[model samples]
Target: MHTRTRVVAFQPPVCRIVWAPRFAVKSASNKNSRRASQHEVKAATLTNLSSDRTERRSFVDCASEDTLHHPSQLPDDRQILQGCESVRAPLNVAVLLSGGVDSSFALHLLNRAGHNVQAFYLQIWFQEDFRNYWDSCPWEEDLSYCQQVCKDADVELHVVPLTDEYWDRVVAHSIAEIKAGRTPNPDILCNSRVKFGAFYEYLASHQDHNFDRIASGHYARIIRGDDPDEPVRLALAPDAVKDQTYFLAHLTQPQLSRVMFPLGSLNKAEVRALAKAAGLPNQARRDSQGICFLGKVKFSEFVEQHLGVWPGCIIEEETEEVLGYHQGFWFHTVGQRRGVPLNGGPWYVTQKDVHTNTVYVSRNYYSVDKERNLFTCESVNWITRPPDSASQVLCKVRHGPVLYKCDVSFTNGDQSAVAVRLECNDQGLASGQYAVFYQDEICLGSGVIQTTGVSHAEIGSFVDDQTKAVL
Candidate 1:
C-alpha cells in the first residue's frame, strides 16, 4: 500500500511559500528502509527550499542586484547589512546629489532598497565671473547630470540656492582664516554648516515633506557607540584611500545621528562598478578636485580677487637675506613653496610676520623642531564623548590618509581647547587648519589650529631684525 503526504512550506514576511504533495511507497520487508529514504528526501527538499529563501533574503538585505548576478564578487550580504536596517526601511529620505558617481549610486541604491528618496543639489556658487576665470567650472553640467539621475530614479529633484549661506558661513570663514595666516578647509565648514546644518533645517521645517534622515555619498561611517551614554560615532570608511572622515569631524552628535552614508563600506572601485552596473551616466565622470565651492578658479586666484595683493619682502631665515618678494603675506602659508619669486633653487615660506608685513623663507623645508611638533587648537568639537586627558591618540593635520601619533593635553583647563604634541616631524602645520583627533579608526573630534609653537632660536634666525624688534 502507498500513503500520500502533503508538505506545507512558509517563509518570513518578505516572501511567500508553496505546498506540494507526494506519495510514499511501502513494502512489508523493505518498509522501514523505504520509509527512511522517503524521510531523507523530504528533509533534503526542505533544506534546499531554506537555501533559496536565504538567497532571496541576501538580495533584499544587500540592496544590490549585482549580488544576485555575481554573488562571489560582492561583499557578503550579512556584512553589508550590518547597521543598515534603519537605511533599508521605507522611510522618507533626502539625498544630497552632487552629480558625481558616488551620489548617483547612493540615490539608486536607496531607491532600490525601498526607501522614499528625494534628490537635492545645493547651489552654492553664484558668482558668474567664475566662468570667466575657471575653465573647468562644471556647475551647469553637474546640475544636468543630477536632473537626469533623479529622473531615471523617479525621484523629484530640488535645487536649493545656498549661495548666500555658503558665502556667509564657509567662504567668509575660509577667507578670514587665510587673511589671518591660517589654513582653512572650507569643505569641513560646508558639511557642518550648510549640508547637514542649513539644508537639514530646510527639509525638516517643511510641513508637506517629512524626511526621517538625510543621506550623502561621503565615504565615512556613522555607527552607534558601545557605551549607552556616548553619542553615535563617526568612523573611517572601509576604503582607507577614499575616506572622508576628516571633513566630517566637525559634525555634532545630532547631525551624525540624522545622516547616513550609503557608500561607507564601498571602495572607489566598487562604487564605479556599481555605477556602471546600474547604468549611471556619470559612472566615468571625473571626481571633483580642490575646494568644492571654488569650482574651476585656482585657490590663489580666488584669494587674490577678494583680498587684493599687498606687496611685501621675503627674507631667508638663516642669513636674513632678502631672497625675494611676495604680493602678500596672507596669500602665502607656512610650508608653501610656489609663488615665491626665487631663482637659486626651491624655497619654502617658513613663517609669516603679519605685523612687519614680512615673509620668512628657509632652504630646508623639512626642518624638524620641537615647536613645529607642538601646537595649540581651539573651538574643538567632539564627535562622541571626549577622550581621557593626556591620552595617546592619532592626529591628522590634513585631509590625507597619513596619521601621526600624538599626545593631547587640555590647555587653560578648558576641555574644548588642547595642545597637541606630535611624536614625529610634520611640516605644513597651519593656523586655522583643523587638527582632527582620532582613536584608531574612529574620528574623535576636531579643533582649529589657533597657534603653532616655534623655538625662539628658529623664529629669531628666520625673522628680519625689523620684524623681531616688533615681536
Candidate 2:
C-alpha cells in the first residue's frame, strides 16, 4: 500500500483561534495588487506563544481551496528532509518569516514533516524620529502577507517589536563605523544580532513557550555530528548565487545549534519552482535587495540623515590634484567609483584621510603592480575554534559567490587577530569590512579588515609638492 502526502492546515492545542474582525486579508481576485480589496474572513483564536500571558491573537483562515495543490502534486518531503539530518521528529519550531516566498515555503515544508511550527515577524524598521524614511518601510504590507501565510498553514503568527533592539545593536554600530571612516555590513550584524540575536533573547524571556529549534529561509546549510558534544558547523547552500553563509559567519555555536535552514539544498530556480508548484501567495514576488531596515529608503539618504554633511575635497592620488569636491568624507568608501564627480575619466577611490577630510582617487585603481591581496583582520570571531597558523582557507571579502583562496596567521599570539594573504588581488579591500573565512564548504568564521597592503607608489609617478600646491 502507498501512502499519500498532502499540504495541510495542522491542528494546534485546545486554545481558541480567532480571526480579528478588523484584520483584513487581500481578496483572491486582487492578489497581485497592493490596494487589493479585503476578503471576508471569519475570526478564530490562536494562543500567542511569544508572550508570557495568554494573549488572544486573531487568526484569519486565508487558505484558498482553489490554490492548494493536489496531494500527489505537493513537493516531496525528501527534498527538504535531506538537510535536516540531525532534526528529531515533531519539533516545536519557531520560524522567522519575512513575508517572502522562501520563508513561507520553509514553513510549509516543516508542517508537512510533522513539526509544530509557529511564525514570528520581526518589526525592525525605522520609526518615530526616522519615520520620514521612505514614507514608511512598507511593513504593513509585509505583515499582511505574513498573516495570510500563517493563516494558510494553520500556524500561529506573532509580531515582535524589535526596533529598539535593532537600532541599538545593528544601526548604532554601522553609524559609528561610517563616522570613523570604516565600512561595515549591517546585514551580517542583523543576522547575528537582531534576527538571531535579539529574537533569541526575546524568546528566552518567555518562560511559558519553549521552542526546540528556530527555522529561517536563509540559503545556508548546517552540518551536525552524531556526538551531542560535537560542534555544529555551518555549510554552504547549493544555490551559490543566493547563498547567505557570508552574512551568517558571525553566528556562535549556540546560535547554530538551535537553528534550521530548510532551503539549504535547493537553488533559487528550484525554490521558485517549488513555491509555484505549492501555489504560495508570494511565489512570483521578487527578491528583496540592499539592507532590510532601509526598505525603500536609499543608503545615501540614511547616511546623510544620521551623519549630516561635512564638505571635503576629492584629490587624485597620482597627482594629489583636487579633481572635485564631495559633500563629506564619511559618505565615500575605498574602491567606490560611483558618486565621485570627475570630468577627465573613470576614477576609483583609492584612499581617505579622515583627519584632512580628503578622499584620494586614482585612475589606475586596478594597476597590476599594486599588490592588493594582503590584509589583516582584527576582532576575529571563530565559529568553532581558531584555526592553526598558515591554514589554507577560502575567504569572502564581501557578499557574493566569489571566494579567494588564502592563508591565515595569528598576529603576535593574538587569537582575535589574523593576517590574511589572498592568492588574487581584490580592489575593494577597506577597513571595517568583514572577511568571512571558510574551508571547503564549512564556514570557519569572520573578522573585520583592519589594514591592507594596497600601495599606489608603483602604479604611477607622483606629482611634486610644487605641482600639487599649484593645483
Q: Among these predicted structures, which one has the highest lDDT?
A: 2
Looking at model 2, which ten-residue stretch has the lowest summed lDDT?
13-22
- What are the per-residue Cα lDDT tens digits for candidate 2 across 1-471? 211111122232111111111121111121122221123222233322122222333232333322322222223456556554425768899999999889988888888778888999998886546645544566777888899889888999999999999999999999999999999999899999999999999999998569988999998988877897899998877444467898999998998899998888655656777888778888888766577667666788889889898888999899988888988899898888888878776788988998889999988886655657778778898998765444446788887645666766665444677677676566788999999987656788999998876333311122232222110
Model 1 misplaced regions, further than 4 Å: 1-72, 79-88, 128-136, 225-230, 368-371, 389-391, 454-471
Candidate 1 C-alpha lDDT tens digits along 227-265: 545677788774444678889999998888888787776
> Which one is best on TM-score?
2
Task: List lDDT for all candidates, in order.
Answer: 0.69, 0.72
lDDT at 373, model 1: 70
Model 1 / residue 32 / CA error / Å: 82
Candidate 1 local accuracy as lDDT?
A: 0.69
